[model samples]
Target: MKLYSYFRSSSAYRVRIALNHKQIPYEYIPVHLLKDGGEQKTSAYGKINSKHEVPVLEDKNVRLSQSVAIFLYLDRANLNNPLFPKAFPDFEKCFELVELINSGIQPLQNLAVLKKLKKDFEINDEQKVQWIKDIIRNGLLAYSKKISDEGPYSMGTELTAADMFLIPQLYNAHRYEIDFTGLEKLLQIERTCLMLDSFKTAHPDIQPDSV
Candidate 1:
């Protein structure tokens, strides 16, 4: 198995946490996104993932994109620890968290959007930061209310793809200097993730290409 990843990408970070949680060993092929004005845009990497995104997983001669799908695939292939709930309702609840992260938080604050604001809209740094904060604040606030019923983790005690998604978004929050205090449940979730080794090892600072 192999993971084509960028060190600072939140999406890639999500998959890294999942791999670590399952104790799945794979070779890491670093795709330096910033060098030469983002390597993910190069023709070479684009052929592997038409979407031109990081965290593409190649296993059993199958190349997969999207972090949640990759997590489910690895969980099924390894069959060691279950990342998603098996019971019908419980499983749906887990997926609810995944949707909240994937659809809610990720799209608004991704690097591509940030860059577009600067390049296309000519938004200054402060404005860009404010835009990011506004979007993330709304999404996280709603998530805090919705996921309140769950335990320390996103959906329950067990770590799911949602938790994997949360840590990286929180890191993005910190990167933008966004204040998370308004979202208490999110703060609790981030605190809990900090205590886990999977998040620790997958952090951008420890990655090979991180500055």
Candidate 2:
């Protein structure tokens, strides 16, 4: 198995944490997203992933894009550590958290979207930063209200894939200097998750391609 990743990408960071937590071994291929006018946009990478995004997992003959799909595949393929309950409401609940971050927060403020805002609508740095801050704050606020308080993890005693999603989004939140004065629950979760080896090794600061 192989993972194509870009350091500082929140989406890729989630997958890294999941892979480490599951103790799955895979070769790391760093795809420099910003180097040489964006490496992901190159003709070469396009052949591998038409979307030109990171967190693309290649195992045997199956190549997958999108972090949620890759994570679900990883969980099913390696059944020892399940990320969520297999039953009805419990399973559905986990996906709700995943989509909260995956769709609600991540897509609106990712690199491509930010650049598009600048290029197409001509938004300036101040506007772009504010845009990011608003999305992070709103999404995190909703998450803080929805999650179980019994946790160091979002879903309670077990560290589900929600933590995998939350940690990276928190990293980005801190990266952009988003204020967390009212988000105490999220702060506690971040503090608790960093104590784990999985999240620590998966952090952007420790990645080989970090610069």
Candidate 3:
């Protein structure tokens, strides 16, 4: 198995965490997203993932895209350590949390989107930074409320894939200097992730290609 990844990409970071948590061994194939005008846009990577996205997981002949889907595939296929909820409502809530981060938050302020904002709309760095801050505040404000009533994890203290989703988004939040403030539940969840070897080892700075 192999994973086509960019070291600093939050989406790729989620997949790396899942792979580490499962103790699944795979070759890391670094895909430079920002070198020589974006290698992810090159024909080589485009063939693997037509969307030209990072963190494309290849297991044998099957290729997977979308960070959440890849994590689900790994967890479901290998039950030694499931990253999903066993209960129906809990599972639903987990998916809900994933949606909050992956769909509601990540897409709006991703690097590609920010690049587009600057190139097409002439948005300055300050404006771009503020836009990311707004998204983080709006998104986490709602997530903080929903998860606060739960356990240490996003849905609870079980370390589901939702936790994988939360940490990276929080890391992105920190990049914008947005204070987490009174989001105690989220803070607790973040602390839990920090204590885990999976998340710690998979962090961007420790990655083999990290620059």
- What's the lDDT for all of these models? 0.83, 0.91, 0.86
Q: Write the per-residue lDDT of candidate 3 for residues 145-179, one digit (tens) a residue.
A: 77836677777658888889889888888778886
Candidate 3, position 58, lDDT: 92
True lDDT of residue 131, candidate 2: 100
Among all candidates shown, the one with the greatest TM-score: 2
- Compute each candidate's TM-score over C-alphas: 0.93, 0.98, 0.96
Q: Which residue window of length 10 is worst by lDDT in model 2?
A: 80-89
Better of 1 and 3 by TM-score: 3
**Which stretches in model 1 have alpha-carbon errors above 4 Å?**
none
lDDT of 2 at 204: 94
Residues 1-211, candidate 2: write the lDDT tens digits.
8999998989999999988988998888999988988899999999999999998999999999999999889988998778776778878888999899999999999989999999999999999999999999999999989999888778887788888999999999998999897889989989999999989999999898999
lDDT of 3 at 24: 91
Q: What are the per-residue Cα lDDT tens digits for candidate 1 across 1-211?
A: 8999888889899888888888888888999877888888998889998888888999987899998889888888888767787888878877887788788888877878889989999999889889988777777777777674567888767777777877888788788777777677777888999888988988889887778
